[model samples]
Structure formats: structure tokens, C-alpha cells
Target: MAKPLVKRAIRGATVNTGSRRFNLPEREADGDWLDAQGEIDGAPAPLRTSVTVETPRTIITRNSSPDVFFDRSINPYRGCEHGCIYCFARPTHAYHDLSPGLDFESRLFAKPQAAELLRAELRKPGYVVAPIALGTNTDPYQPIERDWRITRAIIEVLAETRHPLTITTKSDRVTRDIDLLSAMAAEGLAGVAMSITSLDPTIAATIEPRAPHPERRLRAVRMLADAGIPVYVSIAPVIPSITDHELEHLVERAAEAGAKSCFFIPVRLPHEVAPLFRAWLDAHFPDRAGKVMAIIQSLRGGRDNDPDFFTRMQGAGPWAELMRTRFRIACRKHGLGNRGAPLRTDLFRPPAGPQGELF
Candidate 1:
């Protein structure tokens, strides 16, 4: 008989460290263990993140989800390192036979050829121009972007073609591309939305471990708006008992920082995310765990998630209605949610070449 796999938990990591659930033959760890150095430990070791590069045949992903604003989006990377406990994207890691827990954040994949693939797709005869969205699944400006520069390269291609584009991210690193985006915005071809969940640094750190601080995101909004780029604030996945209280404050502050528009979504715990969020609540807000879940279920139709179209983004029930009311009132007072110039797809020019240029 084969020996069962042993899994050890890593401290200070958002996801619980353990073997992936997808692994087969049903593995279990033995309680008995031996220390290599005979029981000499101060603090638990931290989990190390590893990245793999993939050369995908295609870059643009087509989505027909009515809830999403865009028809197509590009994800330059997979498995975000930001490690937000409530991230809806975590479950995607399961497709790789990796645990949606720690592995979702620690084990990452980058598409180094994203720019090349995008250019090719854009040059195709049947290609149509629309605002291509970045950071839909994984943040294009995550920490590793500094090294890979893949997202920047992709933007360069769009700039060359004068294509309309939208970027959503939690990192201020998007500021680095201001030179490119600002020029595109000049022609009504670019816009950006920065996601900020909480104004409290302590709470921000606990939830979104590696994302830019809320203040930094606000600063980026100011920088982008000052540069002529349309900047919007996304106060997304507002946890009922935790971050929801800051709804009015977040939108008002973002408007003060030059965010012309704002939108928010109630927290949704789909599949594996439910347990992960529950674990986080137990560790951080044990006192309110039951209450929080109870409120969330009320919004999700007595379930952890409501995946229906239109209704999924926002939920039902009085609590959801109350949150929406607060957001609307705040937006009205702050002069936000005023959708201005639309991104222009008419300016796009197909690249001329047999092989797509790598920008």
C-alpha cells in the first residue's frame, strides 16, 4: 500500500497550507512527526511563492456574462499573489489540480507571450475593436509585473494600434504605465478602475495581504485622473459585517481623489471560497462570524452565493437594499457615478505584418 501524503500548514499565509483537494487516492497525514533539528523553532516558516511562465496560443478571452461590463478581457497572469481572502478568482486555481488555498496565491503562472498573442489576434481579418479589459481574473500589475513587464508590453501593442482599453487593478503599479495610458486617454481610448475595499490600513492588510494600501490606490486614482485618464473606484466584495460599513466613506474619499465614477458588489463566497472566508472570519472576527454569514445568506437567497445573471453582482434582501441605498446617497452627495466619455473603438488600426510586433 502506498503511504499517505503529509501536509504542513504555513503561518502568516492567507490560504491554509495543505495538500490540494484535487489530489487523488485520498491522502491523509500521520499525527506523528520528527523534527530534523530536534524541536528548535521560534516562528513557523513562511510559504514561498513560485511562478511558471506559459506561452499561450491565444491572449484575449471572450466572456458573455451579462453581469460583467466587458465582452472580452485579457489576463496576463494567473493566481494572484495579492492573496485576498475574499477573492472570487481563487477557485480558478483548482483547474491546475492545485489547492485553492495557499497554492492559489503562492503558485502562479505568467503568460510571457501575451503581447505577441494579442497583436496576432488583433491583426486577424475578423477581429473587432472593443475596450479590452485587463486584470479581470488576475491583476496584471501584481508584484511580479515589475520583473515580467508582460502587462506593459501588452499595453504598448494597444497604444500602437490606438485601441480602446480598460484596466482594473488593486496595485498602484498601474501608475508606471501612465505615459502610455495617458496618451491613449487623450484620444478617448483608455480608462481605469482601482479596487479599494477598506480605508483602514489594518483591516486592508488583513484581507488583501499584498495589494497596495487603500491610500496608495486612492493616490493612483488621483494620478490617473490628473493625467486625463478616466478613473473609477471599485469598492468591491463589501463584506456585510466587516467592510460594508465603509461604503459611504470609501466612495466619498475616492470622489475627493478624482474618481468620477464608483460601483460596489456585496461579498460572494462561491465554492471553495466559502470555507476559506469562514476560516478567515474565525481567525480575525470570531465574534461576528455567525452574524456575518447569516447576513450574507440573507442576501444570497439563503445560500452562500447567488450566481444568477444581473442579480449576482448585487444581491437581494433588505440588507443588500440598504447597502445600495447608502452607496446611491453617497454617490449623489459626492458627485460620482457620472459616466463620461466612452472609450472610442473607431481609432483602432490593424497592425501591418506577418508576425505581430512585440511592444
Candidate 2:
């Protein structure tokens, strides 16, 4: 029999772990490596993040989901390093034959050609302009973006083409692009949604390990608002028995940070996320893990998740109703009702061809 992979904690990571398959002991039809590891190991070194370039021929992804706000989106990267255990997008990595656990965090992919491809797509003769949603799948501004600059490059392309854009991210690093964003906002071409799940540092750290601190996110919200850019605060994945309690307080904070509005989603455990979340709760909040999951199940129509369109975003059942009610009340009290003005698509123009720079 093989040993179960050890559960360990990595700083800035929810669960310093890998998926079942990735963690499997190296089977050599022999036990030499396992014995050798035991002899020399005190504790294994922490996993390091690696980035790979993904060259995709296209950049914009179109969708027809009635529930989502936008029809077109761009994901500059695959596999987020933020390692939020509750992330609904975790299962995406499985498509690449990568683990949805720690491997999803440490093994990352960047689309350096994103900006160029976006330009090409925009130049297509029949291209129709709509607000391009950024960071819809994996965060566009994940850590590796500092060196890769794919997100910024994509933004530059959007800004140059006069395309309307909506960005959602938790990293304060978005502030680094304020110059471009502010320029677009002035033209009614850009808006941003900053996701801040919890105000408590400890909770935030554990849930979104590599994400920017809550305070930093708040500051970024303020910065965007001050720049005359529309910014909304997202209290996403409101986990029962954990982050759910912070709801009203978070709404108040968002209002104080100058957010135009606020919205939240009850945690959704779609696909592989349910097991990962269950393991996370067991490891971090063992005492109430059962209670947490019970409430979640009740909200999820007696299952780990409710995939039904409208219900999936806000959840269902009494618990779900209560959460929505609380959110509405809080928003009303804090006067955060604005959803920001509609973005203008009229300003869009195709990228000025390959030598767009020579102008």
C-alpha cells in the first residue's frame, strides 16, 4: 500500500497540497526512492510556482450564458496562484491533466501573445464590440503577471482599440494599471470589480492565500473611485460558518471605500471544488466542518452544489434567501445601490493593424 500524501501548510496558500494523482508516490515497481526520501527528509521543501507560455491563436472567448453579465471574455492566464480553496474555477486545470489542488496554484500558464491575438480578433472585419470581461476565469493579474505583463498588454490593446472593458480581480496590483484604466473610464469604456471575500486578515489569508491583503484591496477600491473610475466591491463565495458572518460589515466597508455597489455569492462547490473545499474545512476548521457543509448542502438543494443557472450564483433554499435579504438590507443601509453606468461600445475601433505603434 502507498502512503497518503501528507497534509501541510504553505504560507500564502490555502492548502499546501496537490490533487490525489499528483501527490501519489513515485511508483518505480521498486521502493528505492521512497526509502531514500524517508532517510533524508526532515520536511519537504515548499513547492515553487512555475509559469509556462501558452500560445493560443485566439484571445476573446464568447459565451451565451443568460445569467452572466457579459458575452465576451478574455483569460490572460490559466491556473491561478491565489489558491483560494473555494474557487469554482479549480476544475478547469483537470482539462490540462493538472491537479486542481496545489498544482493548480503552483503550476501556472501565461498567454503572452494575448494582446496580439486580441488585436487580431478585434481587427476581424465582422467583429462586434461588447464589453470584454477580464479575469472572468482565472485572475488576469495573478503574481506572474509582473514579469509576463500579459494582462497589462491585453489592457493596452483594449485601451488602444477604444474597447469597453470590465475587470475583476482581488489583487491590489490592479492599481498599477490605473493610468490606463482611468483613461478608459474617462471615455466610459472601463469599470472594475474588486473581490474582497472577508475583512478579517486571518480569514482572508487562509481563504485566498496569495491574494492581496483585504486592506490593500480596499485601498485599491478607494484609489479607483478617486480616479473617477467606477468600482464595485465583490463579497464573493460567502462561506457558511466562516465568512458569512462578515457580510454586513463587508458591505459597510465597501461603501466606506467608495464602492459604487456591492454583491455577493454564496459559496458554490461545483465539480472538483466540493472535495477540495471539504478537505480545506476539515484541515482548517475541523470543529465546525460538518456544520459548515450541512448548511451549504441545505443552501445547495441538499447537495454539494446547485448548478441551476440563477440559483447557482446566489444559492437556493432558506439559507440562501436569508443571505440575499441580509445583503439587500446592508446595501440599502450603506447606500451602495449604483451598479455603475453602462459601458459605451461605440468608442471601439479595430486595432490599427500590425504597425499600430508606428502611428
Candidate 3:
């Protein structure tokens, strides 16, 4: 009989602890212990269990960054388990003593007090009314949201106050709040952008492991549209040499699905995301790695990434020009709106409160 394969948990080495470490191991082929060691014997490393934590903090982060479209945003959770290698938000995990690679997708933090904090912030005297952006940092509708319901609670507060809000997500789970969203849309208080990276299921599975399937996202777009909500199709971070070819096709499909507007952005590899993306490419598509990066650099002014304002979102150079031209042509061909039409902000009405309340 063949021996069973042993599985072990991998952990980071402690500071100044030599090259030796300890880990528990078990068989892979069968649920049995093969060996136990307190010290390293030049064997493989072990894997660790995923840890989830709950955090209490104020919601509604204010941002003055000129690049962002919104002045304020809300994120119900930290650390996305969707595990997209190209996620620019991955670096945030380092602040929590976690790896931006595997740990980013496993370790998660949920804000249970988000609704209360939002209510308090809204009730403040000086709070200004603007369209609050949701899922700006981490997706508010991630799988854990099913139980936390933090996103829903925040939405409830916003709805009660008639605050204008916008949501961007890659999950079909957002459909659960369609009734509220549709009502808000009727009052010009809400809009949604469904991010569809690729129509190919295989590529989607590899790039966004835990996100809803592409077909499902398309269905979500249709549902939102049918509910009288403004729906936009976002083909974000269009990976060059990879999913770039699918731009026009994706736009056509989204248009058919009732999306009124379409947008696309060249890929970005900011911070630690660069290394993580490179690792993922090497693991999944080694043969096309160099070609893929080469195309990205072409768009990014001969660099791995371009962080310049105005240029970052749309890139420069010939490759950038080609992508822009293609997108424009696609939008025209499909009758999609030129760019996302700006949501109404002038119509916002602050929640009713005391006469002396701060504005």
C-alpha cells in the first residue's frame, strides 16, 4: 500500500529564532498522523487555520484625496476573502500583522458596530449630505455579510434618512437589498455599479476565487435594472494581454443585460499587490506572464504601474490610447453612455433633527 501524504500548517518564523521551527503535521491521503516533531528536520512547512476577528470602530471615513470622486465612504469589513491577486486593497492587511498574500484572504475583521456609528455620524450637527460610497475599500457584500448584516444595517439608516448613496460590488448578494435600492433610485438617492472583470468563468474562478460567477453578476445587473435602479457595468483593472481582449464583448453582453453605462480601467499593481499578482501569474499562467506584464508596462508609461493622477485611472502611451479607443468604439457601438453619468448630489436632504443641529 502507498503511504499517505502528510499535510502541515505554514507559519512565519519568529525573530532571531535560527532557521529551525515547529509545526504539527497529518496525512493528506488519510486522516491519520504520520509524524510529530518539535523541531525542524528539513521537512516542509505546515498550514495554519484561518482566523476571524470582530472589531469595533466608527464608520464613515472622510477622504479629501483629490483622486477619489466621493468625499466620504463606508466599509463594513476589513480583509476580503475573495482573494483577487490584483486587489490594490491587499496592502491594508500589513497594518494588522498579516501577510498580503494568503493571509489577506483568510484573516478577516467585521465591524459589528457599523450601523450605530453611522447613525451617530449622521445625527452630528456638522455632518454634510453627500452620496456615500460603499465597498470603496473592502466589499460590503462579501460572504460573511450574510451573517453580519452590517452592510444592510448601514443601508437601512441611509434609507431612513434619504441619504444619497452609491454601491460598487462584484457580488450578486447585493440583490437582497433591491427593494430598498429601487425605492432610493425612484428618489434619485441611489445607484450601483456591478464590476464584471471577465465573462469567462475559468478566468473568473482563478482571479476572484470567492466572488460570484460572472454570469451571476450579469444577472444582478439585469435585476437591478429591472428594479428601476441605475446600473453601470464596470470592467475594472482590465488586465492587459489577458482579459483585455474581452472588453468589447463584455460591453455588448452588459448592454444586452440592461446596463445603461460602461467603464473600463487598465490594470494597476500598487504597493504589495505587485508581488502578489506576479506570484499568481507565475502559478497559473507562467507562459504568458512576461507577455502580460509587457503589455501592462506599455500602458503604464514603461513601468510596472503608473500612480499619477488623471493618468492612473486611464493610463498613457500607445497601449493606453488603444484601450481608450477600443472602449470608446465599443460604447458607441453598443449605445452605452459615454462615461458614468454623475449621480445627483444637489438634491440631497439631511435627516430631520433639532433646529440648532450642526450643518
Candidate 4:
């Protein structure tokens, strides 16, 4: 009489499970909207992604976490369309009364006024000139970006003001703004990090259903590097059994593509992301699901996640040590040192308006 485990993937338009309950792990709870809707009664209707305008009063977000690198960041979008099952940002959607499962990918919010808001903040009399990070919460170049162009507009403002900026993304689309980024790099005002989790296309597709292909991302690194932009390759959220095996090969590939540095983090499963990732493992790698979680726990100090300041970013224990050792060896083998230079705050010029106009 019990419902079966889920087979729903991160991306799909329809579902058909006759005479059985579709046990979506993240939404199986009693108060979940998936169960409340009961829309799966017949042939599942097509699920489409929707974007809503988010008109927040401000744009720059301040961070004080010692573990985090940047003090201020900006998120042009709320929910990511990349659909990476291991995204730590997934839990943020709960504030909007939305599921971190399907809704996080399908229902999105964009700040169309991000550029204008950023200019106003920059024009403030006491504003600081530290580098602003993009793609910290959600990928700025996610698929919807092609049409929205909000990220582009923000970059335009940064370039116009000669503000220092750093970008992290998984899309080759970053190359589309090579003109701005390369110009910024000339003044030592910009840097970029491209995350390449897996070299095998199948694994990349399974985990990040909507992200650009691994090969394309590598090529993007090449293009960015060739443009004189400092390129750092990040093997972020390294899943234990799923992606750990590719750590060395991914490093090699990234180095071949002209990465100036390489780094990695063990997977993080805070809040709702844990259940969703577990369900994804059940659906995709049923044979190795238990083993994966076990190793993750070992790295995370016997819990599914460790939210401590320093320990969260770099896991502890024997497993974490082994990963660090391996990563060190790989970076050495590929001649990729942690060499990304700090962006130049000295070159920053405030936007030409308001409080900054007379400066």
C-alpha cells in the first residue's frame, strides 16, 4: 500500500505513472503543493518555465561570513534554470512559498532593474569599491538570460564605471560579452570562474540537466582566457561517488583550456536540497545511492551537511583530507596554481550621476 520512490528527473515536460503515486522526494510531505494540486490525475500537462519581474528596492547584497570571499554580491535572478540537483541556493525559494524541487527551476524571478539599482548604490557617498560577485546565488548566464539580458545590462554599468567585478557561471554564453570583460580585464578590474563538474557528458547531463555541455564550458574557458581575462576553473560541489572520479581528468581538461587556477568544494546539501538530491540519486544511481551519502557524511562530520563557517566550505575528516591531497596532486600535475589576481579596486569610478557626479 506504500507509494514507490520517484523517477522524476530535474527536467521533463510530462509524467505517466499509472495506478501508483509519484513520490517526488522533495514534495512528498503532506503540505506540499504537488500533492495539493492533484493535477497529475490524467496525462501530465506540459511543465513550462515562467519568469516574474522582481522589483526589489535595492540590488547590492552584503555578506559578512568569514568563509565567503566577497563582501558584496548581486543576484539578477532568484531561482536558477540550470536545474543542478546539488545547488545550495535551492533552499532560497522556500521564502516565496515555492518548492525547491520543480518550482525552483520552472518558476523564476528576475530583477530587471538590477543595473539601475546598482548604479544608485554605487553613487552613494559612502559606497565602497570592493569587487562585486555575480552568479553567487544563481547563474547569471542561465538559459533565460539570453532573452532577459539583465546580466548584460549590469555588466554594462560595471564597465562604464570601471568597477571591479568577478563572475562565476556554467554557461558558454559568458563569451558573448567578451568585449566588456576583456576591456575590464585590461584594467585589472575583472576575473571569471567557470565551473566544470564532469567531463563525461552523461554524468553532467544527469546532475545539471539544463546547463551547457561540458565541452562547451571548457571551450568557454579557452575563449575567456584568450581574451586576456583571468580564468579560474572551479570543480564545485564535487559529489562523492558521482563526480569525484573525474576530479583529475576535469583538472587536466581545464588546464588544457587555459585555466589560470583550479579549486573545488565537496557537495553541500542544506535544507530542502538534501531530500531533492537524495531522490535524484534514487532515480539515477540507485545502485550507488547509499554509498554516495555515506561518503558525503564522512566528509561532513557524520551529518548530511555541515553548516559551520570554515568547515562548510572545506569539509573535514579522512575523506576530506584524501580529497584535498588528491586535488593538490592534480593541480600540481597540471601546473595550475591558485594564481588568480585580485581585481583592482583602485581603478573603480563611480557611476556618473547623483552623489557621485561631482566626484
The model with the greatest TM-score is 2
lDDT of each: 0.85, 0.86, 0.78, 0.86
Which has the better TM-score: candidate 3, or candidate 4?
A: 4
Instruction: Order candidates by TM-score, high to low.
Output: 2, 1, 4, 3
List model 3 lDDT by residue over 1-359, tens digit each.
Answer: 64433322222111111111122121132213334432534344544335365655668788887777799999888888676767778777776656666666667888888877787788877777888999888888988888888899999988888888999999999999998999988888889989999999888877887789999999999999999999998899799878999999999999999998988888898766776677577767899999998988888888888888878888888888998899899989999985455666566455556454565
Q: Find the 10 residues in a row with the least total lDDT in model 1.
A: 24-33
lDDT of 2 by residue, 234-343 (tens): 89989999999999999999999999999898999887788778878877899999999999999998999999988889788899999999999999999999588899
- In model 3, the clashing pairs are 5-28, 8-46, 8-47, 9-46, 9-47, 10-46, 10-47, 125-358
Which tens-of-lDDT digit does each residue in 151-229 have in candidate 1?
9999999999999999999999999999999999999999998999999998888888888889999999999999999
CA shift of 91, model 3, Å: 0.4
Taking all chains together, the TM-score of candidate 3 against the true structure is 0.84
Every model's TM-score: 0.91, 0.92, 0.84, 0.90
lDDT of 4 at 221: 98
In model 1, where do residues sit more than 4 Å from their true spots? Answer: 1-39, 355-359
